[model samples]
Target: MAVTRTLEADVLRRQDPELADILLGELDRQSTTLQLNAAENFTSPAVLAALGSALANKYAEGYPGARYHGGCEIVDVAERLAVERAKALFGAEHANVQAHSGSSAVLAAYAALLRPGDTVLALGLPYGGHLTHGSPANFSGRWFDFVPYGVDAETGLIDYEQMRLLARTHRPKAIVCGSIAYPRHIDYAAFREAADEVGAYLIADAAHPIGLVAGKAAPNPVPYADVVCATTHKVLRGPRGGMVLCGAELAGQVDRAVFPFTQGGAQMHTIAAKAVAFGEAAAPEFGGYVRQVVANARVLAAALAAEGLAVTTGGTDTHLLTADPAPLGVDGRTARARLAAAGMVLDCCALPHADARGLRLGTAAVTTQGMGEEEMPRIASLMAGVLRDQVEGKQVREKVRELVTAFPPYPG
Candidate 1:
């Protein structure tokens, strides 16, 4: 679908001009800056429309047709559409779209499969593991016995041999395979084999790559993992929510876990928006969008490398990449601040095998803005100039504003 020129700001302003101004202010910020954040993207107006629809009023407390609350008939249809769309999109026998966020979906997966004291193996925090994987402060760590695994010290790749050894040594109840900053495609088949050897359940935390999977730009984990948990947003371009995919045998357990075990009422509005996004992703155009996202990311990673950043794994196969900027005379935290001052918005992530932070960025939002590989080198050059103190902050911000103005996310 074509991007729209206007939003429903008139109605919002009529009701509350104060809050409306805040909304427009955010729009201005987004329009004027570069969105290099890996975990962010622009949702189509159709998805946004569903989020602000009448479905928001509904408080559906359970699955479709089995709600705990009365008057859920209409919302039931919305949830059903979301579930079926997710199932079809991922080729999963069953899907639950009710989890409130990616972490909630992972919690449900653990609830459905493992006991409180069961041991689980996951990527370590320093190696790109999510907080839900095994952070000491998270519920996963407080409840389960989590064994951390690290990547290869030299290659920055998941040490499969080490993972297998850990799996066999610990005999964990579950093994998780995914990362927030690992830029390569995961070998789900290898993970499946490791899980099988130990009779452990394979849980794929595909929150970042699920969007690429939807567009067939990356491998899908649904076929190999016993359970797959992911967010509906990110490059999927849906509402901010979560989903779980599994085979039919685990459908009942997963659904029950998502509802009564982990969360209460489902967000019907977000479900409707996810349904819209899944439909969009199924279209042929979304495939092109995702492919371009990867292509642009590759260009950006290489250009950043040429500009003195130590690109992780040498480069990337997905939409996101992590790079060390020490050679540019700044660390990752300082580089992030400098980039922000130059109108480039991104995140600082953990650097595997190093104590210092690294910059993680992606091309998802820029691809949504219709940028291509041609623009990536320019972005890298500007970023390097800012980090090296070779250009004035005011001048860089002005150039960034000029570039984004030509490709407005919501062009008028």
Candidate 2:
């Protein structure tokens, strides 16, 4: 499972020198920079190997033991392993690992439960929700009537009373409880209670915190919600793939929705990689990794707050922290660029109910690189200096490279 760049480079350089150059350049970029993006992670070499395996050439159009093609005898094992590992890892009655992305998983969940005109209550994009949850431009918004729920402006936390009120008023067919940028833990119990009162199916999108849930650092959403959708690449530290977990009752419906309704042929290679990640996650070492992810996030938030940035909700209970850097007289976009120039990558996010923007920082990727609580304060200080225009980005870049060199991302 060791990554051999020479082997891949030799193959690519023979047919596509330009692409080989670009791929190697990206690997170098990742090795040298601090990847602080909440939605990103460094997948294992075993995963990379699985993604590049011969399974990629197979065209298995259906589920295991029910493939439409004849040459799926071996690929069936990969798919079955992925499904079983996913179910065991999350304690779900069933799991579908065919969805190509987290957005696709959400689409499949909606396809299984709601009609085109059915109403769905979900968190708003500006309030930490993903675009698939119901942005005006997405198919979810175009097909169904999506009612938005948001955090309180004063507390920066979800207002369950308001959510309950909205659910009672709208009578949505489904209610989604999740966030892409929110820092605090989601109240799945509260969401379930509101959904029950409205006779709605509660879907928990655990894309950002599935690893924490697996490691017992966050509450499990599978027991509280009817269906859970997540991407394997975030805190889970797997390849870029999506999964939908549901009860035995809804398993058949969800499977049909994903295979024929939403996506076409499944990526067997990615499924193989997902199985590897799920197995790794089930190990005790992964639990320690996720615990440190949360611990490091808390340290990073405190360090940023000490530098005068407004850490939203005071601090984080998960892998990410949302901070309003407007106090430093810089917009989120500008701050992101400044940080990137300093070799510390992060995303610009919109604050709750405000026209201004903020930063969403995560510790999952850094933790994957062997960074701990002690390293977070230095990272925060570097980011703060660049955002406040106190030090040159080029100067900070040098410090970042020095730190990154000490902990190689993919050490052989």
Candidate 3:
């Protein structure tokens, strides 16, 4: 959809002409291209409207009912609705909607459970895990002792046995589960059992698959873990924010940690936008969209594999997949650049046992743009062309325009 700005041109010209022109060009480019980034999506107009609502003016420092500032009655209602809807959608005893992003949500969870310098076990970054999961350069690793486990080099799957052994040896305060590029369903029950053996808290970072879980396409981690942290974007298709859900027993600690421990005044506008998104996800059509997202990923994976590209772990059971570019004789960065020239917009991702020979592709953004099975083959063709060295920027750009034009975007 084309974003029509209401800002007067003369006003923008006087204030910041160069910056305004660049931003407008970017908006126009996005409207004309296809997006395949796994962690990105297009928010509904309602969510965007709420994001720019009057709620942005408010400053409600504390929780609902116990505010540190005056004139928060309506803001309190907006926040409570967000909390109630999130809890209902995720089947959690409590929910905190003030986290600014997934990273903040992880910090809040850590604050509630483990002290600084405690031992934590999580997946390795080279094995499809997130930076906050324990990367040495990240705050989590600097503050806490981190132990990591990797996927099997042979099966390209999580090595549960190795994880179990590590848990026994490390005796970590928390065990984090979930991945950014993993292609299979997570076994939360197994993770729970492992955590129980070590008397450690099970933390499920379902930041990527929360929407699938909410749609019943994936298993629920809340039943198996002590705490769950997820982003409102991704499959949720909500505002860019984070949420923490836990049992009633841990509600107080979670709330305190999110507010005074991690952040100050909440972004009331973001919270209200999150509430709107949660409401949209609860609709019947949203589940159908998620189902289509999984289907589209599988179709795209099969097509790429057929064209001689390597699909990590054979195929995907979720909305995202990793296409190994080693078979095409290229690094992830090169492959990503080539595809971008063709108007395809996935990101470079790590491959199993390889440093960086894979590209991550997702169906969420395009699916939301109303592209379906009809366009998957064309996207695959574009990818195949890039792999075969037959497509360049000019050719890909034209083909991409044709492909995207076939599926008219919903009016913004």
- lDDT winner among the candidates? 1
What TM-score does candidate 3 get on C-alpha atoms? Answer: 0.96
Show model 1 residue runs off by greater than 4 Å: 1-9
- Score residue 342 of candidate 2 by CA lDDT: 88
lDDT of candidate 2 at residue 123, scale 0 to 100: 93
Whose lDDT is higher: candidate 1's or candidate 2's? 1
User: What TM-score would candidate 2 get against the native?
Assistant: 0.98
By summed lDDT, which 10 consecutive residues of candidate 1 come out lowest? 1-10
Candidate 2: segments with Cα more than 4 A from true spot: 1-9
Q: On a 0 to 1 TM-score scale, where does candidate 1 land against the true structure?
A: 0.98
| Tens digit per residue, CA lDDT, model 2, 1-412 | 1244664747787899888878878887888899999999999888988998999999999988898898999999888898899889889999999999999999999999999989999998889988888888999889999999889988899988899999999999999999999889998999999999989999999999998998889999999999999999989999998999999999999999998988889999999999999999999999999999999999999999999899999999999999989888888889998999889999989899789889998999989999998999999889889988999988999999999978888886
The alpha-carbon deviation from the true structure for residue 239 of candidate 3, after best TM-score superposition, in angstroms, is 0.9
Cα error, residue 397 of model 3, in Å, equals 1.1
Steric overlap count per candidate? 0, 0, 0
Query: In model 3, where is the ten-residue run with the lowest total lDDT?
Result: 1-10
How do all the candidates rank in terms of lDDT, highest first?
A: 1, 2, 3
What's the TM-score of each model vs. the native? 0.98, 0.98, 0.96
Residue-wise C-alpha lDDT for candidate 1, range 1-412, written one tens digit per residue: 1322244435777788788778778888888999999999988888989998999998888788888889998888888888899999999999999999999999999999998999999999899999999998999999999999988989999999999999999999999999899999999999999999999999999999999999999999999999999999889999899999999999999989998999999989999999999999999999999999999999999999999999999999999999999998899999999999999999999999999999999999999999999999999999999999999988999999998888888765
lDDT of 3 by residue, 357-377 (tens): 689989988888788876787
